[model samples]
Target: MTTLEKKGSDGGGSSSQEAAARRGPAGPGRFMGGQGTEKSKDFKGSGKRMLGLLKRERPLLIGVLSLGTFSVAASVAGPKLLGDATNLIVEGSLGKAFAGYSSKAEAVAAQHGKGKGKVADLLSSVDFVPGHGMDYSAIGTVLLWVLVVYLVALVFGVFQGRLAALAINRAVFRLRQDVEAKLSRLPLSYFDKQPRGEVLSRVTNDIDNIGQSMQQTLGQVVNSLLTIVGVLAMMFWISPLLALIALASVPVSVVVAAKMGKRAQPQFIAQWKTTGKLNAHIEEMYTGHALVKVFGRQKEAAEIFRQENEALYASSFKAQFISGIIQPAMMLVGNINYVLVAVVGGLRVASGALSIGDVQAFIQYSRQFSQPLSQVASMANLVQSGVASAERVFELLDAPEQTADPVTPERPDELHGRVAFEDVSFRYDPEKPLIDGLSLKVEPGHTVAIVGPTGAGKTTMVNLLMRFYEVSGGRITLDGVDISAMTREELRSGIGMVLQDTWLFGGTIADNIAYGADGATREQVIEAARAAHVDRFVRTLPDGYDTVLDDEGTGVSAGEKQLITIARAFLAQPSILVLDEATSSVDTRTEVLIQRAMARLRSGRTSFVIAHRLSTIRDADVILVMENGSIVEQGNHDELIAAQGAYHRLYQAQFAQAVAEVD
Candidate 1:
């Protein structure tokens, strides 16, 4: 019996003091979530952690950066080269302007005599030849260089992209692997408090978001920032005054990004939170779809889904809308800077303080500087959304892990299933005592039956026995060795459990039956099925043992599913068997068949039978009636009835009507 049985929760959890251990629906603020308006408490901290995840890929990252640098360097040189070509054309045209002169210097000297004019000063820098037109050959040379430089940048860019992709994917792959390992390390109690869908969202949706965020932003942000720096250097080299004017927009762009990012971050967090919540609701409703239909809750479920969807849509829209403003806002600032630089450059050209070609290059540099800024702003949303997901993933990674397995674990030499609980005490809540100082022993090859009402700690005892939850005090031993000292694998390997809820994965009938025992042979599977009375029903199918079942085993009846699980247990052939109301789902005839099969399977093996129905376990060697986490009556059924205590009263109440009808 698991913790859910003790709480009687059909959903993830229920309201019970002891149920808190597993995590009730109304649990502490951590798992159940607080008011659903929560955001990442630490943004920069999570961002650092997200970046830190790429530590192992530092080499690949360095290679990517190296290629990107080369790429940017090549791209930056193109505008300057084009400017040089422009200078050639302007100088050649000036040579054509004074075509009748004997030399270009004579023409310039004729125009300005012995003193210098503004045009003459500008012409001093130009290499003008008499009768020369536009320098088509030189322009062609510069164009070829431009083409060569751009091609080089393109090659480097492709390689940079490949390397960056490899790095990001590898980091995400490792993160996925870490989360997978972490799930095994987490205690069952951790899951008890959290919805399955919420956890699933963290593993699938959140992690995927982290990968996408990094993929879309990491290299792009680096490239954009570097482009700004490279372009700034060239801008200042061309003309400091225009460069200053272009840079004036930086503060405004930064302000817009910072403010909008701050506002949008909470919305992204809310969006993901609502996503997890909605997934949980969908999963719950889908799992219990039959129940919803039976109860006619389709309209209510649809309405609830609509509300959550609306919440998700609102949060998403706000996040996107806020972040969306960044690009146009940045473009506005960039355009203003472009106009200022152009006007300033035109005046510089008019005064002959700078050549037209230099002013043209300066204008290009100004545009280059602002373009990357717009790109960075545009990708801000991906970065923010990714960081939000990173924060969530980090939460799962930071969740307190289960107690470590013993370094030097003990294992029983032989499998004699003598189990004992010695002065064992437990509590889901420290203040609320449960099963205090309770002690019980079961001999080898004997069956111990635990009968109790809901929340009576019958299931809790089994949970403790299975070491699902550690005992608050004392110890539990199997075959004279403390069970806690043994590794969980070793402890559980000796025991076989058939839970009330039959789980049959998507596989053939033979595979589901052979699931528990590794390397189970076909004969072994068939033999186990025969022993569990599953062979009779299975043989009637068209495909026989090869018949495939869906995840929920839809084609099979409830009795058939239970029988299949029983067959799985039989295949395991464990020394200790636990049957937790295994026959409850079957019909009277099927239940009788199961009891007979279980009796045979229990021979020479220590078995613990937990039954809610009283009549089934009347023949057990020992009967313990539990209430409020302690044994209130103990004996065989006949002896307990003679005592007329709790067990006798429960039996009478359950069977009195049947007894009257039969009499």
Candidate 2:
């Protein structure tokens, strides 16, 4: 038996054996394996393109930058002003304490009279006079000015945050819209090759990451850069020697940050990739939970989940741990510089080369200088992750899109449903050709049934006819007009399809039925439902036609969902119809009803029916039996059965199986 058949049959196997089969011996790696953590080779180019997304909001960006600059400037100046106030207080207090001595010294010097002796020198040295006790008013005035500067800085900081938020939100909004539009332009094969969860991650998770990074990092980047420059200048103005000592630690901090960033980047990339894989696995498991339970593979599924979760945890922890070290490492360097400046500035003050207040301001500037450097280092990781996300989003935008028609061509005013494949050939891969130079023609209002074993390319033929995929070597025409000549929208407007896998969005039953016919009236939807034999079942529901369905149409049975899709196609009322195993999911009674409904739906349309149940298509005008992507037998039921070819053997086998089941 095949792996799937064995899984279905095994009910009481050893846990290990069942798990090995369900999850494969490779564990979760088989499901989680793919391109892992794609790092951008051209980071600068990606960063430029990422920034280009914000170009439309240049005015907002400029406003944010302006406000941020004002805030940093005020912040830088506040410390100096406070230092000045400190100086005033110190000088006033000292002068007040020496006031009496000054008066005594002047009197002694006058009494000595002779200008040459030790007493004269001592009196000169003791020259002191009493003055006003302290300048409390001047100190208060300076303090008041300092308060105003800080308050202004706070207000400007708020404005900068608001403006940056607006700009980032608007830019991200535009980016999301572009990605949505790009999805529609991409070829169907692109989706076939990619996981739905991975694609969704790009649209939701990746885009949000970019937005958050911008909002958090943009304002800080502006403030940090300005603070660094302003503080460095202030430090040099106070004491060039101390400034050089402070600047000495920057290169060491930079080297440490660079090394950590390099280590953390790949971890972050892996974190996001594994995050996508985990989501994909969860989606798959939840979607097939019923099957998993039916086969008693719940243990296996949980084990698989545990494995994937572990992988995600490992990557996430490494990424956070590596990036987390940058801040502390930078602060370590900053503290070393802080101590050096304090020691050196104190000595200089004792030597009278620098005043106490000037040394205090220099220390404040040194601390300020280290803060922005640390902030910038931390911002580096956030920016790196954002750039990685941007690269993914850009990769989606840069994927190969379906070719556009060279010129706009007008579609026929009315379609007659005549389709001809003139030597059509196609292959998913150029190296392995599937269909080779096949030709066929069908007149209007004829029904063609296609039957074959699995992998016979039955669905592929339908895809080609619908132009979901283009022919590689030949032309397919609709009513004597080449399909490629018209736009995809115009070409597909005349055809309707109903597949075995029914799809329904989250909405009321009436809305889903009316989806195919834009601006269709309520009465028209009911009429189409009746024609597809869905009106009876819908009327049985509590809300009737207004009943809401979930995304997966969970409340309804599979057969019911299939009927609703048929109703949708019926409402479309196209000139050509394609049905691929439309009744495969229904019971015998429902299948009969659906076959009758389908017959009515195909009354005046050219129809192609792909059915595994050969009994349903015995009355078709022609039955084409395909094998290995080419027609091997073609005739009506009686003719093909008498010929005793592939069709006869297929019919005979099915007949024997049915008889055996009855027995």
Candidate 3:
């Protein structure tokens, strides 16, 4: 059996056993053991938060508006110039398309004699300059004006793009920094209830949506709205009756777009949520690939992945389909509006009721108006998605945080190496207390061992002393000072914890050892490593202390990783030490090495050892046997064995097992 199993068999083995069991047959789809028991409340008041965020960035919004207006103005000027050019060409410059050569006096008298204005009356109003060919110079002047207008329009286009790009980029950069800072300040409980994957999606994907909306769609929407307004006004100026018919398409398009956008927004949000979930499943599958193969559950894992993937695809399709239709439908409506205006204006020009210039200008204005409308319809989809993502981000930002570490916290004048828990009680959830009204104390320069069955709160006791969880109904003090009054960083800086679950980051061996004390010298690191028995192994490596390790030190054995954690703790040299099943992963021989190091480190500090192997703590000043959430016995090893109580019974069982192994 592995040393980890042996350690488990000796102390709190059943709890670990149950946890391992849950990793297999009973585990939930990719999100098993890490879920918190408590459910998070549904997020609320998102609009208020959004409004607040916008208010803080009012300057940016104003800048977008100003630039967008300028772009629209330049755009509008282009059509007017083209319309004037067309008018110049269509007038006398084209040299009388109609073949009638009668003067205005003769045509009007002839029309009066015929009782109503005949076609001659219409032709008479159109200046029939006798014997004059087309004025190409006038046409050239109009064309030149149109060309200059287009040139300025191009400049405005470039200006608008640059301004929008710069402002949005700067604004979004600042926004992300602010959001990240807010995340850092939030209490641990905020992370506790969320899957790491989902939280990261909000920080990354959701914000990316907002950026897309701003940088890609936001300016377009604004310019489009302004264009629509300007176009409508110009249409009205040309002919109010024609303008009224032209704008009939606007209300219909707006209603249709509003209905579609409302339906599409929720699906977009749901799509993002499912994508996050699917990514979580994929991450888990890759991370636990070895375990999946070892257990021969590959087929089951594949089915689980397929289901999540399908769900994400379905949501994405639904969202995109609805949003995608808005643009084409809007263009269809705009086209109809344009066709109606052209037909009406052409009739007015044919009847000599409007000038060719007026008809041409109205057509240009109508297109300008309808084009912005179409743009708005397209941008509506993006804006809705952005709002949806914004809502999710706001939800995360508004979550209730765990307790904050104290500000202006007390700092100790000197180190005493004493720790105490008085009437301490704690519950991860309020309804289920793990440690209930329990009290314990350890003096300076003493080694204490905690042993218990599964769910006996032995680890909880150590956690309380370390202040990972605050006590629900009591006080924990270090050196006779209440820990709640001290800053968490200050309190933690004075305590060293060596957990069984070893985590070694990717770095040089020396760097990993000195992680606990940022600026330790080479000699100090070597000494700590020697004390932890990793120095002997380090010297044998190709790079000695400079050997780089993979994440969590995959290059090293589990036992070696545990030793590195111990070396890190030793280097910290805190007033209080916690060895939480620290030597559990190492073999018996390596445990002996770690035990010797523990003895040396415990000489002048208050130390708490959660021991599974009873032999390692034979010299402990105090041994506490815990059952359920209460202490069943406490005394020196010899005294507990003499009493033949809970501790005595457990020790004999392990001893008998050891003897049987020898045989």
Q: Count the backbone clashes (under 3 Å) in each candidate.
A: 1, 3, 0
C-alpha displacement of 221 in model 3, angstroms? 1.6
lDDT score at residue 382, model 3, on the 0-100 scale: 74
Candidate 1: how many backbone clashes? Answer: 1
Q: Which scores better on TM-score, 2 or 3?
A: 2
The best candidate in terms of lDDT = 1
Winner by TM-score:
1
Ranking by TM-score: 1, 2, 3
Candidate 3 local lDDT, 366-402, one digit each (tens): 7777777778878766776676777778777667654
* lDDT by residue (tens digit), candidate 2, 1-663: 000000110111122243345434534455455334445566789889988999999999999989988999999998899888777765565457545545655544554665544443433332234453567888899899999999999999999999999999999999999999999889766765566777888899999999998888989989999999989888888899999999999899999999998888877777777777677678878888999899888887787778778877887788788888999999999999999999999877765577667888999999999999999998877887888788888999999998886486867667998889899898766676777787888889999998988767787787787766788988898889888888887887888888877788899999888888888999999999998888999999999999999978978998898888888988998888888888888889878877898898899899999888998998888898988778899988999999999999999999999999999
So what's the TM-score on candidate 3? 0.88
Instruction: Compute the lDDT for candidate 3.
Output: 0.74
Candidate 2 weakest ten by summed lDDT? 1-10
In candidate 3, which residue pairs clash?
none
The segments of candidate 2 whose C-alpha lies over 4 angstroms from its true place after superposition are 1-40, 101-130
RMSD of 2: 6.4
